[model samples]
Target: MMIHKIFPSRKHALHSWNFVMFRFAMLSLLFMMIAAGCSQVERRDDQYSISQEPQRIVPVEMPPSSDIDIAPSESTLSPKKEPETEFGIRLTRADRYSVNSILEKVLEYGITHVQLGGELITTVDDLILNPEKKAFVEAISRRNQSMGIHTYIWSSELNLEGRTFHFNWTAPLVVARQSAYRSVLQAVPEIDGVVLNFENAFLKPWEAVIPAGLPPFSSRERIRFVIDMVRSVVVDEMGKRLLVYAGTGKEEYATWLTEILENYPEEKITVITHASLQGNEFLDVWHPHFRTVGLHRHLLECDLTASAFGGMRFFNCLTDDLYEIWSQSRLHDVKGMIGLVEGEDFSRLATPLQMNLFSLAKMVFQPDIPPDMIWNESIQRVFGLFPASNEGQSLQALLRNSFFWWRRAGMVKGIPLLSYRGDLPEHADLIQPLKLIDSDALHPGIRFLLDELENPRKQTLIDLAQETLETTTWFNRAIRELEHIASSLNPSDYEWLKQRFEQQRLLANVYYYIKQCYWGFRYWEKNKSEEEALILEAHLQRLQQIGEHLEQQINSTDEIFYAKRIRDFVADIRGHFPRVILGWRDRQWNYLSDIRIKQAGPESVELSWTSEQPSISRVFATTGFPIFEITKSAVETPTLEHRVILDGLKRGARYIFKVQCSTEDGKVTNSGEYLFQTMPAPLL
Candidate 1:
């Protein structure tokens, strides 16, 4: 069947006015599909599947411009100086600025374009459904255009409300999606283009769209079909640029993207990829996709919010890092970069009006300028210039080394504990597993932090402990160093800079204590030494102090909800404390957590644990060795909280065991290997 029905046929008839508009939109899409060379002809797969193989839409020609240019305002301020590269800023949380503040910063930083995300209008669905939001966004778009700055609407594909067009891409869903895209363009006709990042999605449609999966050629073509379907309205009909996110770091993705771009004219489809491989957690080296062939001609997305490193709400300055990103982008295709400025939703990150937003502008213009120099200039702009002294250098070092220190501390053994979403506070289920940082693994979907940490040749627990402590200790020390110089500076500048540095210090310590707390448990599991347990206790106590501090600060939220999320974050971490503390001396935990050796008798060894939620526990044990062999006993646990005793075990025998917990849905996580010894028989 073809796309005869967009929504299930309504028993009630559409209003006469809405019916006319719907008719017009369908007609426009039909015209675009035919013009864009989307073949409606049936394929051989029609006989095999319930639905027909959807005909692919591929753009063959550029159509005329749809939007009329608003005459530039006579008072529009030309940038005092614009950089050669066209720099853009994508505002996730746009409420941070008014129309003039946005334009003033745009002119100040020589920004050419602004990509507006959910902060203003929320989503493309809002534009189609909410008249009030559409009016507000439309007014803003016009205001931006009047100032001679381009504006692009951010669209998350298949992610609109009531339309999660995920893996299943039948003809009806595809056509409905295209119709929705057309409606957005038709409604907000003033915007330059749409920034769609489904390509950057965790489960990218190219790989997941088809269930049994299509061949390479078919997969690429299928994505092209979706692209061209949107382009038919956004580009071919409207003469607008389509900025697609090229986020997959795979060379194959690059190859697919290169082929896709080759099919379209230059500048028709702008491919933006993150400059950081690990999505701006810290220690962000240039992404491989950023250096790829066709992508060089596109833009690099640089995140200034520093979501994982405490965002802009806390001490957030990436002045030096921005220089590196700008340098890499300059070396690549030189289309410039986009900074993700401002707080989004209930995220922990906030884009304070200050915090060196202009440093990015400074670095790109003078790429060779020292990071310290760029930061010093930005600091001078905010507060009066530092006197000829070490005070300036100390301040510079503090900002420059902040990111470096945070990365070393936060990412222990080079693995990040990521939230399900992009470091949003509301999505704080963070005591989860670790993810492989920046590896372009052949396959997608949850790659393990455990798998990487378990590498035999990787850094030992002791080495990680040392490095994490050193980086964090120095960072905290640097925060303290600012006090000595506070007397030399004006009180307000001192307070402002100190607050930023203090936030960094607190976050660094948080990462440090959490890392030590977790790693200490794992380390103690190996030898179960008294000294290690004492150290672990100390780390946990510090975590408790930090959590208390965070609670106090969040209590003073000052009406900024972003500041309040620290409560959720710290609470979540605190929630994990007692569970991980299960093995410490004697603690009864009724939750799912790390496997612990509860009791060992002369003839029996006991293994105990809890789960993330209610779960069934299973234990596999091997005797007198670290490896589990074919003859190893497999014990099944009946409930979420469990203590399984392996009876009739030889006395003084060392048992190697792994406990895995399965949720009701059958999702399982096998925690660390534990060592246990049965009591010696009669002290022989």
Candidate 2:
């Protein structure tokens, strides 16, 4: 090679040609080698011929016309379905009320669930090993019953040592409390869960004064400790899921508590809220699994007091707050718990007053009534207590004075009954069936008040009271008529009418819609700044699209069937819309991912998504598809994942999906989708 190079360097023509030839030879060798490799691959491929086996096309056999039963061939007769009447009472342990008697009364009223009072479990020892109490609990359970243990350990009077007003957030004490509570629960197999009186224990400590010596724990820390305690009891000791109910007053505390519970399984923990404190903020925190308590005493006393005063001022009070809370809870599809403070005398005016109050409380926590109608009906019911007679002037004066004080307290309006502007015709209509009476029938002192109003000196009070009474009467009549119509119609017809009523009612109150939107905006603005506003705007646009599509479908339907269909649709829409909207918002906000839609069957469709954090799913129906089924499955992966499946979809239909997600930090996200269609019918 050296000699050859030297020859080339010498600029010999033969040497240059030889060098070129050598390069060409090497290139040819490379190409040949590559070609050989390619040939071997081709040969291997040729040897491995995948046989395209003849496909056995099995012809689908359509049933013969005689055998092809489009409709169920057995009979067109409908099943003899039993009418369902659900009734439950809030069973509490008051000094005057016997637990056994109350239990019997509950059976009489067909009440199913009871919230056992903390007083019932007077001491830790009582909670753990009281034989009589244990026997009672066993009896209750044996009768296919459920009991929510009032409390494990709570302070009525917070002191420095035992039963302190303030909680000790130190790890040792917290852990000890958890262990102690767990031991109690384990010892008593009948106790369902613990109801921690957070509000009574913390915010409104029973101690008359706060002690200066001890350092107070931050609210967040307290909430965390409580949550940790619950986890220790339920997850560690019980070896099964248990409920930790923080009976809270403030929405902020609920938010904090929920944040801590985000680490626990949704099925394992639940938040129980008093009816009167429900609001959008609270709803945002608890969502689907929030449990509401309808306490009878608050409903009658506080709510009635506010309504009698006519300012709707009571709206801020716990009693008045429950109406809206119940309505909103139902609207949000949250589970509701009704507590009837029964065995108290309703025959006494005070008795009725108490009864009404508690009834109102229970009503507010129900996942039933429309929200718009909630306050109006509640107010009307309260005002129904006034009498028609001019006698008992003193009583009337007392009532008016009480009403006046309520108004001054910012619990109600000072306007005369008729002068107040809050009554809705539809709400009034709904109330008629409950047989609500006018002030004359309701208030023993009303006659005297009426007389005083008609009297020359009492004209002012009379004029206002009369107007309010008249308006209430009219409202009551209208509601009665609606009820009559509801009763007379066929089941399908009644459903349709209900839907129509809801639609008209909601539409009529555009202000409420605007208010809700504004609230949503405010929430976003506070939490997400300008970015949230943009996201919300996008959501509104999506909602508009869905609304338009729904409108078109609704409008095109037949008029005769419209009322029933529309009513059912509206009810379903109300039930399902929030969930879908919230869910979609969550997805868009990066709270979760992997949204999947699965077709379970002809009658069912399931929408599922994944979140690394703990979350909840709520399903709603908008139209003909009236039912849904939710299921969760575990998937085996390097990192274990959960797959949630929703089934029971209607074929040839469109649906909307709403989802909401929250994290342990109290960060909430929502998402929604509209006009999702089920898969087409399978080809025969």
Instruction: Determine which window of 10 residues in candidate 1 has minimal summed lDDT.
Output: 45-54
Model 2 Cα RMSD, Å? Answer: 36.4
Measured on C-alpha atoms, candidate 2 has an lDDT of 0.36
Highest lDDT among the candidates is held by which one?
A: 1
TM-score against native, each model: 0.61, 0.33
Residues 122-237, model 1: lDDT tens digits: 34644544444465566666766777677788775544212123333444446555665665665566677788766423234455434344433355665676677677667776
Residue 660, model 2, lDDT: 43
Error of 1 at 321 (Å): 1.4
